[model samples]
Target: MANSKEPRVLAIILGGGKGTRLYPLTKERSKPAVPFGGKYRIVDIPISNCINSGYRKIYLLTQFNSASLHHHITSSYNFDHFSKGFVEILAAEQTLEHSGWFEGTADAVRKNMVHFRSQNPTHYIILSGDQLYRMDLKAFMDSHIASGADITIATTAVNERDATGFGIMKIDNKQAITEFIEKPSVDVLKSGNWKIPANARGDLPAEKEYLASMGIYIFNAKTMEEMLDNEFTDFGKEIIPRAIKNKKVNSYIFDGYWEDIGTIRSFYNSTLDLTLDHPPFNFYDADAPIYTHMRNLPPPKVNGAPHIENSLLTEGCMIINAKSITKSVIGVRTIIREGSELDGVITMGADFYENEEAKADNKKEGRPNIGIGKNCKIAKAIIDKDAAIGDNCSINVSGKVYPDGENKLDNGVSFYSSEGIIVIRKGAVIPSGTVI
Candidate 1:
């Protein structure tokens, strides 16, 4: 482990992706800000992970629909004024070097080398902005220095069936990565499996399963700066794999549970997983609490019947009347009407002041004025802000919201809502009594 005299660790969160998979939700804001776990966005998971890991110096790289994300960061996180370490959101501005948005994950980091230089960090940790995990990164950094390696990529034990879809690794006795394969075939190690044998590296410690890259990385300052100079744009595609053959790239096998909510089905499943009897991700741990950009809102007020079960209700939520809620995640300022039904769904209140640009363009403009309508039947759905649902609107009741349209998501899992779903966009209003 590296010495702990407060080593300078700079974390760059890649938040520029247009998550089309979680559409309607991502339509108005960037992927990270797309609401998750009821009151949080997928981005919060990573930000909180950083917070939990004792990393205070952080930079968020964003581009498409970055306004809301920027706003949320400012409102939720305010440590910048008093701490030696700070957390900030840096949007990719158009300069002579590049005129458009970030090209890819590596490009995002490459463009922000100026930020790293300004921070004068000794280590650079690049992370997927939309992943879910809780890690003690301080330990990961210590190991990086201990191995005397140029770069260290985080790895986790996974079923090959699950590992094959991710970057697989073969590490040596000293934890140095021996070989690399991206999204290998199921037959690479075992049929119906996707993990690389831990013993393949021979030096790896005992574990329950094979190790796979988690897309999290730590690089020696000089090594990362030099690698960023090339044409490599995507980390997994060009950076890590290519660096394995040249630089001393190693792996830190992580045993904790980690999940990437990239696709709609995967994203949906991650949220539902929080309801598990023993959730893989525990947010209640005071010793290791997930830090995130806070929403600066008042805690919720359940005015009417307060029947919440296996649900995550955030601050500023108003439940006018409800018999009981089972398996639901409700966002801030979200209001549920009288006699309404909600099951396995995410809901939020919309504010018009935030989307002035879109509102001016007359895009789904009706949603900003009102809240979700009274007595709307919702199930397995994701409802965005300022969206109003009419009375008695029954969304995907069976969780299959889209029966006709071709879902272009990687999962091709059709509609994200298995019990049926409906997205009201930023400002669209669902007419009263309309059944979607």
Candidate 2:
């Protein structure tokens, strides 16, 4: 077997399409570029994992709303001139051969084969840019090489409730995956044939009968080239299933904290969970810290230290005599005025500080300044960057209050609510005495 350290590995992070499920958040930026946690972008999870696992040469394939993603990547990850390790963005473009955007995950990589050929890597690691997980890629690569297989998939055991959303698989005693089904129906799972035999279950929970694909894969360079030579557009939907019948495919079972932030509900819930005493996914790990753009803003300032419990406040925030803040993630350059109370909120904070002139202009133009206005009550909502909420406005009103689906509100930038979570659009201005 070849030494895991000796092989050259290239990491490819798949920037997802339109991201309609994460609507307003993906309205202006790509899913990966959306602000995550208090400060980092969603893309940082996979990129950080790659770096921590000692795989530095990485490429991110982007298609929709890539401008902000480009800026973020160029600004955040800067390698030295002497090192070949770099993070770059390969956007979809029309060439002489193909004149279209990335149709799916596999097609995205296939289209960028010209660039991949130059790197000449021994193995390729494919990852999802928008998921939240910290994996040791070196270990995963080692498992792939040790399995003596051309392609290896990283899978996690999930319960029946979550099984229908993922590609479920059945593996043999040798850890070789023999059967694959994408989003199998309830009746299909009830057949009891897809469940892994008890002897082959390994250390996974007994309740998690199905192994769901985590959308993470490792492919031998030659095998990837050969697989992409065809017209298959998706790995999970096409390439992978076909490869299982012809190639020796293996599964690397991962029992770790992984959350796919696909919708506004998932994003909001996962983010707020960080404020827990012990979060499922830890961002405070010193050995493998999550990295992001270093804005170098000053430390957060609390005026009177008004009630703050189970919250994360990032740099450059001014909490001025707030009544209380609980179970929230406040972003950079946030200015919470006096008498404002927030619970279960995730504010992306402002991009740039509004100067005295900007504030004067806002006042003159009959607008509130950038941030939460005074005496406002916000609950179960996401306040986007540069959102101006005027004083005495009640947002979302109650924790249980949510629209059946999506309800559009008109005021400043016309805010909206999805799955009961109110989202104030970026740069939106809610006038005084406004209520939603």
Candidate 3:
């Protein structure tokens, strides 16, 4: 049951960025390695898409806190030897010929050209790591082969407010890209540097005036090798613009839920979106499920008839008489004590359980055990892994629209308030009777 006509495609996931926008979260791990949807990492989206699309030979390019990422990939993805399917990570390394870190996205790919070339793929599928969306990549590759394009860029129609944040594309009736602008300003759009005819706009509403690049691309193997020969540092800022003029570049329009998790606000909002009754993006699609490192944990336990609504409670959570929880994502190994309340929160639960001896030691040292404590009220917050909140704590940010500032409380606890969403850093300890 295979499509013999389909080209042998190699998927390359770029996971090397520093993730400066998602700081604090990305402080200890790479952006792709950061947890999402309670139990999955950010890198799982692209990798799962590749596997579901019948493309098994995958390569992940990563740097900067890649140890956890490596562990997750190796432990999660292991194929049978006869299938010749594999998922591998290629970190930035120094060789006799080259001795520097990956300078940019294009550079990261260029440096790892030798490894990719060894796979002998007909076409290359390039994807970003920090985006959340589910797409059938086989259809994208089929469109690329049908178009006979040297390079095909995946595009989505966006309204005026979002046009400036993306690489806008101007395509002819034949789907050939005429011009490409990276993050064009409002004045440029008004000047009519690039325009789309009404007939060629497809299913996009008339209000959505521009086609924005999704940062996903399919390149013919030979064409990519030649393009990488040049001294381009980045794809969006450098290579793609030049390629539009010289090469047979086309566009594949994708009309689906896609969000580039680039900033804290975007990441926060997108993660919280999953708690909606009918989310734009969902993880429950059995036909194409997102895969991650599975843990052998017990089911979540809810005792004392706690009020819960419109929330995702992951495995190994113990909720004992919590007052209420609404619109939140509770991660693995979470423990919510009596009289606690959570609203619009994301608790990234503990990495490990604290045994009785550990709890005793914590009490002796005047520190709270891991997880939330009793009589606490948390609203619009993100509690990172292994955090300990003492009893009678309040982390509500009701009136603030933006962060007034961050503070480092006693016992090495760091608290950051941004866009009125409080973030308690990983392994932080908040003593009793604290309020924010």
Candidate 4:
């Protein structure tokens, strides 16, 4: 079953930069650690994909706000003594040679080359931590080896509007990428030969004319070392374009449910899409299941027969007499109290349940307990972990307009509004009858 000539591959996941675009979600934890699909973190997708693809030796590189991410990874992944596989994080550090934070994706990997070299991998599979997709990376590596490429980029056919936001690759009939342009303008796209060749189109849709980089790359170890030998900070902007000139670069086209959870709008839309009857991305596939920390949470409890429809309620939730819950994702250990209505909402849920003492303390402070309170109506919003929403409050109510960006309530509690959705900050407490 083993091809002795096949190169040993190691996976590298780039935990993104400050993630300013994601805003309050990335305020405390790194972007990869941000929770997704009610139960899993963003990092879990790529890590699970790697595990399913038989690549277990992985490294995640991050610099800012990594404490929660570290905790999540350590708690989730553990291999047996017989296996030489491990998932580790390589945070940016100050050494004699490098004293600054990871300037960009390429720089981040370059700084950790000393550590990765110790593992003696023959090639590297670079992935983004915040994307949602299931890929057979073993097959991807096989394609790379068969093509005898120094660098292989995973690309997906996207429409013209979406193509401008990504690095467009121009490939020949052999799937060999001949040119690379980073975020080309519309004029350049119309004027330049940026279209994929007809022979290579295969099953790609006719309207999807351009091939956009998916930020997934497989690199020969020597070629990667050579490419990172400079001060080039980024791969798309510098490293990739330069490598295209001198290296045998190829493209692997992927046509699947791939979503870059880069911005609030994209993240919101992607999460809600999971509530569909047949989601584009299936998490229930037993052959390639997504893995996360096993909290051993008990099944959710619904009392008084709340009306529920097309929602994802994770483990350890108590739904008590809710008026209705529609098209939402309720996270672990969440509590939806009596007479509350939630629609198109994503609640990250509480870390730990509030005992009697905690409830008493909350009562003394005139704040609601850590969950949605009675008779509240929340819609098109994200309730972060351990947030307390008091009774009879209105959030993102129908026909009620609210300004976007960071806004504070009269009680000094902070919440964020982006793309017309309200985001209750983690550990925030909204007092009784506060309307927004």
TM-score against truth, every candidate: 0.84, 0.96, 0.96, 0.98
Which stretches of candidate 2 lie above 4 Å from their native place? 1-5, 398-413
Quantify all predictions' global Cα lDDT against the true fold. 0.72, 0.91, 0.89, 0.93
State the lDDT at 319 in candidate 1.
77
Separately for all candidates shown, the number of backbone clashes (residues 3 or more apart, or on different chains) is: 25, 1, 0, 0
Quote model 4's TM-score. 0.98
- Candidate 1 Cα deviation (angstroms), residue 105: 1.9
Superposed by TM-score, candidate 1 places the C-alpha of residue 224 at a distance from the truth, in angstroms, of 0.9
Q: How would you encode candidate 2's per-residue C-alpha lDDT over 1-436 as one tens digit per residue? A: 6576688999999999999999888889999999999899999999999999988999999999999999999999998886679999999999998999999999999999999889989999999998998899999999999988999999998888889999999888888999999898989998958787787677888788889999999999999998998999999999999999999999998988989999999999999999999999999999999999999999999996569999999999999989999999999999998999999999999899998999999989998998988998999999888898888988878444655444555653366778778888888878888888
> Model 4: clashing residue pairs?
none
| TM-score (C-alpha, index-matched) for candidate 1 | 0.84
Query: What are the per-residue Cα lDDT tens digits for candidate 1 across 69-104?
Result: 988887776675556666688887888777876788
Better of 1 and 4 by TM-score: 4
Error of 2 at 25 (Å): 0.5
The top-ranked prediction according to lDDT is 4
Off by over 4 Å in 3: 1-5, 398-405, 409-412
